[model samples]
Target: MASELHEAIFMAKQERHKNLFLNYRNLNNFPVELLKDEGMQFLERLFMKRNSLTTLPENLAQKIPNLIELYLHSNNIAIIPQAIGELVKLQSLDLSDNALQIICPEIGQLRSLRHLRLANNQLKFLPQELGDLRELETLDVSMNLLRTLPERLHQCVSLQCLTADRNLLHCLPRQLCLLPDLNELSMAANCLTSLPLDLGRSMELQFVFVDNNAHLKGLPSYLYNKVIGCSGCGLALQISDMKQLCLTLGDVTVPLPSEVKAIGSESERVLPLEELACRVLHAAYDWTCKDVKLRTPFLMPKSLLDVVQWPLGHCHRCSQPMFTIIYPKLFPLRETALAGVHRSTVSFVAYCCSSRCMSTFDLQA
Candidate 1:
């Protein structure tokens, strides 16, 4: 086995091969022959999956500076050397199914990285520096021990898909709703109780999966047609168990507010001053904010501007953008198709802008 591995490496060096495959080698350590003297500068891709290698060389980048792809899946690697950040040209990296506990902050320096997979690890937290990957498009951190994802992750403006399923996540950062290019999100089998009210408001977000979240009692109105999987949700948890889980998760258990603010009806004619102002500002922003010429003089205070930009949610009935306040109505999960064939009973909270809209609102409609 050693002779065969050495022969393969020698042949690759002689031919100046751009790609090297050493998968399923049962090797317990990185071959010293590969890193001796000046490394394979011409190497562009390296495949070492299903190996017994436990750690990476500190001079891996210095040896193979041109690496564009690195696949180290199904390894016993526990720590990624700081030199990993030196792979400035690395575009794809897969460290899934390993024993990694903490990701080094230097990983954020991979400016050219586009794809990263760290699934099936023992990671308790990820570095906030991950947000610096402006080119990152897909991130998978599934099957870990994470309690929360970085709030700065919203800075990954180019991100398209994010999966953090089967973890200890109690709540997701509301800032994730700002990702303009994000399309799919999967956070199944967690301990979530509620989701951000503005989630799924983005036109690009078309699919969401939150199945098996036993504590998730309700979903936001914006996810009406977008939610893909929500089975095994709304399962009642014993008060003692709930309290214990909350304590275990620490401050991450603060679920998004889903209480019924007010029920709209035909009898309520007087709209609150705050609500009316918000509606007016929202309408004005929608109208003239798109036209540069008309937008010039419509200056709003920073606080009001922020509120109008990120509204509480949209009305479930009329699809009208709402800010600060919502006239909420609740419906049993069984009443909606989202429940599918599931036997568990949960509820979906619908938001309305006014009493008039609430009077005419229907969960089925």
Candidate 2:
């Protein structure tokens, strides 16, 4: 019955119409039990887009082996069949907006695939075998939860564009630079803290998308020439003895000497605020004196304070914040004078202005 229905449609196409449109005909849900193997032998293009298909018929490619393009977007598919590799003449495959969790390793066998779209899926990782699709030119896997990419991606020598934004990746595969034909690379909204040292060394790389990742610290030095937003000014170099280099770009903050996996313990790289202030002041001024500004609320050590501001409970006399008062400067002290009286390094200690009545009471006490 299904074969007769398809035959009738083709007969109609040949009788009165040179072209026909048969989209969204609810053909995906039918069980017409036709001799599909021989009927669809010459079928080259199939559009099953926007359906409720959870999986494709296993013998589909075997029947329509000459198929070149397939659109199966907007489905509930959780897995792609390994038999997809048999579509030797396929040039494009759209599997976007699906619930797919894994990419079949056999997909790499489609050497003739030029465009592949797997965006808006639940994939956490990609098969390294995809790098074998040397004829692939466009690949889009946006809006997924990928963490790390396979280094074998460099094998796609003919790949010219790759879009992988809105993922959880912390870093990129360094081997990406080996793709001499790559022109565009998008890696936005990831946990990236820094780029590989040789990222922009690729002369063919023309555009890059690295925004929306506020925790990202630095870009490769050579990338300055290609990046328009940085104005070619890459990570500023600073000399310091402390392991971490703290930099405040307006309200956002980032630390250098980025987190690295060493032995067993994970530690935060920290730099003293005094050293940071000295560097900032010395860079613009000709003065030989290395002056460290008195620390304030902004530079409060995270070790001592769990919150941002000093609470009134820490004060002895007043129920308000003491020490480190923010007033018109009468020459900020390099170190608080209260440092001599109280131990604990006197993080903050300021004397409240005494009133005439309070002074008389203080004399009596």
Candidate 3:
């Protein structure tokens, strides 16, 4: 007696189906049964989400060479098969909530791909070849371990929306601003210190979310015309810029950056940080300050103060604790108050825990 899968396969062959839906199936392994027949030759879309798939079937390209959209969300997929590159016609691919560690460079072969989602994965670095996906428009790499993006990404001229929130990136690629079609960028909860100078040149850009980056004092001069989300941050932007901000809190009370010692030592070589216990704390600690006029900010977790051996306070402008509780640091955000005369300010505030991002004193409390 043929099983349900066999029946489905028979139906697909008989009807010459183009779309296949097999979601919510307690599938432990790829259903090789579906590929044994020639009927799948016409298959273009495949939905197999909510399954227990640990890995993709070998030779998936051989079975569904004509595939366009593939949905494999909520699976235990640790690695995408190299054969994935074979599906040249693939456009939309969803591999969210998987255990993937890295994206295969072969993905660059998908010239027709438009949308790609890799959120909620363990990816440490992306393959530079991904820039070859010229047709890609929307990309979500949020909640990953990415420290930097490939500069080659500038080649993806069609990108419209990019979301890279909750990553360890300390800076962004300037090439990102070269794209003329990009419209929206969500980079909240990152360690970015500054923005690309050409950010204002993108005619299509309309929305940006860069809040929660403690060291980011304000947008580049060019972005002053656009209103973006900027709460829980200190800025030197004019009051007009603050007023234009998107905030859930009543009014935007933007404050100046913390005090800065000098720009010389600030330009020192970069240092690697141990995996941060919390990126939120790291960014916040860098911007919290007792005096709103200061150039450096200090927002630290109380629990971490002792572990890092940071003193209560010292080098007030540098936010550097008296002791040797050091971590990776970035150049301070230089704010010019004249720019934000008409800005809106918010009252949302938090005190620093130790000096610098590890402030010892509470600025707000």
Candidate 4:
């Protein structure tokens, strides 16, 4: 009876049953022994989804050398071994709904990989080498806590769909729109108030879901007239002349009130002008004036100050402040603010609550 059953399964494979669905049956380990004994050589697709799998078997890549599509999703797997990269012919991989925290950097070796899904995982960030997946066209990395993207992400010239919605992305990687073939981008629930000036560089873009961004106010001139619908289908857009649409953020300079002083270990020190500009623009710190002199009625620009009161308390316009008791540093949203700045960074005057007051006292003017 056992020999007859094995022969029947092998016969099914010989009849071109390449797609196998062995999911939801509490499959612990892959049926490697059964498959090897049956001599099933035409296997190309395997589905091990919805299992109680804690980890993959040690020799999975060796057993499924010809497998083009593998689905290990909705499992308890935590780690994807680097050996998985040996499957050079693999085109699609689904590891979503797992306990994976770190994406193996060796995944870039899958030269034929086109669809990679790591959604619904605990990944904090991706490997910088992920840009090496030159053939990747669809990548789903949503529902994670990724703060920033790797700078080399622009190398994936073939990427068509990138879904990174519902993450902690403060700013979209400017290089994202540089992909000439990219079509869809979903960045709904993030802190992005604006997109890259060169965002219109992509010629194939069609749909963009940028709702739910509380801080976002407007789009570039080229994208202004592109807002289409705003209902169940979401506000879609069909843009033209991408080269004329995207524009970089304008260079705007404002003044601060109080004299900038570098807080030191023992004593206060004056910072250099060049270094001060870098820090003030990029690394503005939150400070409370313990003894401030109201020079001329404390009138500040609304663009500079988030809040201002009688007893001047200034929370510098910066990214989220990582405040510590001994030392603290504020990171800004724009990296260009630090452009052409010096090292051993000095303290520059950030938005002063009394900017208008200070302007009235301008010596040259």
Candidate 5:
């Protein structure tokens, strides 16, 4: 095996091959022969999958400086040297199925990187500098020990697909909803109790998976049409748990109600002062419209402006802008038409601006 491996590398060097495949080589370390004598400068791609290699040489970039793709999947690699940042032209990197506990922040220097796979690792957290990869399109950090994702990841403007399934995430960064090009999101098997309200609001986002979240009883209405996997949710609901999921609008913080406040029509009820003010301000500011050509300079405080900018969410029934409060209506998945399709036990929560919409809103409709 050793002779065969050496022969392959020798042949590649003699021919100045642009691609090198050394998979299943039973190698325990990066072959020193490849890094000798100026290295294979012409090598553009390297495959070293399913190896016993534990670490990459610090001078790897100096030797194979032109590498565009590096595949080191299913290895025992525990650490990535900072020298990896020197691979400015690298476009794809796969460090999946490894023993990595931390990623060097210098990884941000890979300005040309488009895809990064770090699944099946022992990572506890990722660096904030990962957001610097403006060209990043796909990021997979599944099957790890991550408790939270970096909020700065929203800067990956070109990102389209993000997968963090089977992690310890409790909540996602709300800024992630601002990704303009993001289309698919998967967070199945996490400790998430609630999702960002703005999730799936983007037209580009078409698929969302949150299956097996036993504590999550409700999903934002925006994800109603896009949610593809949601089985094994709504198994438990506690009033104490709901209290922790409060929605803060401007200076007012409202706890998510565990049950419907009332069961009357709109005319039979008088709107709360806070709710009424929110509705009036929303209309005055034309908050529902995508474009606002204000005729005068708006002088509202930043706190109030934030409320108008980000409402609780649009009413699921009337599509009216909801702020300050929400009349939540829950529906069992088995009773709804989606039950047969998704096979989920999770109950869906529909948000309404008033009791009227809440009474009339139909999950089937």
Candidate 6:
């Protein structure tokens, strides 16, 4: 601690200043000179970036007590001082571009902290207590040696951006899909092999960067639409096509109803919502062009009925739904060689919404 800095503290005390600016100093040790006056007790912010600090004061809490923000970036810090947990009111703490190896579990003690930056460090592991930061919003842990993140991390429901790119992570925690407010996620250059199936439907995710994982199999086919950057992945050709369609009008498919999964185990496991929408819309239009005098409803197997549902959609022609007694109908045809035209035993299911909308089709007829 320099005598000039020591005198500056005394003057700050007399002036009741709440901030201390000691950045850009070539100090190799924490300024113990400030501790000479308990007047430092009122300090709420500390600016000590771009210094030669190898460590922070062990009794920092006792010396300053009221720090709400601490800027210690661009330092030679190898260990996070344990006294850091004593700052209960800390809202922002920047420890970027350091040589830190271990972060104390007591770091979870900062209940009010919202922004924490630990980028460009040599961290090999993180304390599970990190999940206790419930109010945390932006967590930047990029450029580290982390292989995996704690599942308890999902507890930070307020987290919006999770940047952990350039790490050695292999698999992502499924709990990550439970974060309802997560909007941006970056996991590029990791050792990832696969992603959670429902990561696409977790929230209003706007930006996701999972490119450059050589071993990653692929993401769920739906995620391609929600994400903006997905190059360098190994997604399947068919899945890649559907991903593109979803980016346009894939109508995004949904998992097969539980009842139908085992029966059609060898076929497509999911069905597109657009297929059902087009079916009813086109059927409604066809019902109008043809003179089908009688309308009737037939019974379906209880197993099939359990999963069958008419997804809501607008009519294709007039856009008016046919919900009347004389409108929308269901026609069932049994398996036969020539019942319709195909020489197979496959059943045909037709549905229409209403006659009014159907009447709009082939008006020139």
Candidate 5 to truth, TM: 0.66
- Give lDDT: candidate 6, residue 68: 88
Report how far off residue 19 is in candidate 4 (Å). 1.7
How would you encode candidate 1's per-residue C-alpha lDDT over 215-329 as one tens digit per residue?
A: 6655676775563554311112222222221111222222211111123554323433455455555654544457645653456675455555554445444555544232222
Q: 345 in model 3: Cα distance from truth in Å?
A: 14
State each model's CA lDDT, in order: 0.73, 0.59, 0.64, 0.56, 0.74, 0.63
- Report the lDDT tens digits of candidate 6 across residue range 46-155: 88889988987777878878888899998999988777889898888999988999999999999888999999999998899989999998899999999999889999
Error of 2 at 210 (Å): 1.0
Better of 2 and 6 by lDDT: 6
Which stretches of candidate 2 lie above 4 Å from their native place? Answer: 1-35, 227-365
Scanning candidate 3 in windows of ten residues, the lowest lDDT window is: 341-350
> Which sequence of candidate numbers ranks them by TM-score, best first?
5, 1, 3, 6, 2, 4
Best by lDDT: 5
Error of 6 at 250 (Å): 37
lDDT of 1 at 289: 55
What lDDT is obtained when candidate 6 is compared to the true structure? 0.63
How do all models score by TM-score? Answer: 0.65, 0.58, 0.64, 0.58, 0.66, 0.61
Q: Regarding TM-score, does 2 or 6 come out ahead?
A: 6
TM-score of 4: 0.58
Q: Please identify model 5 stretches exceeding 4 Å from their true place.
A: 232-365
What tens digits encode model 3's per-residue C-alpha lDDT throughout 1-365?
22776677678778989998888877888887777855277889999898889988767888788899999988999999887888989999999998999788999999999999999999999999989999999999999999998899989999999999999888899989897898988888888777776775666887777766656644565554443544311212333322232212223233322222222466421111221222223333334555534523443343453323323123323343322221122111124342122121111112222212311111111
True-structure RMSD for candidate 2 = 18.3
lDDT of 4 by residue, 64-110 (tens): 67779989889888888888888888999999888888888888889
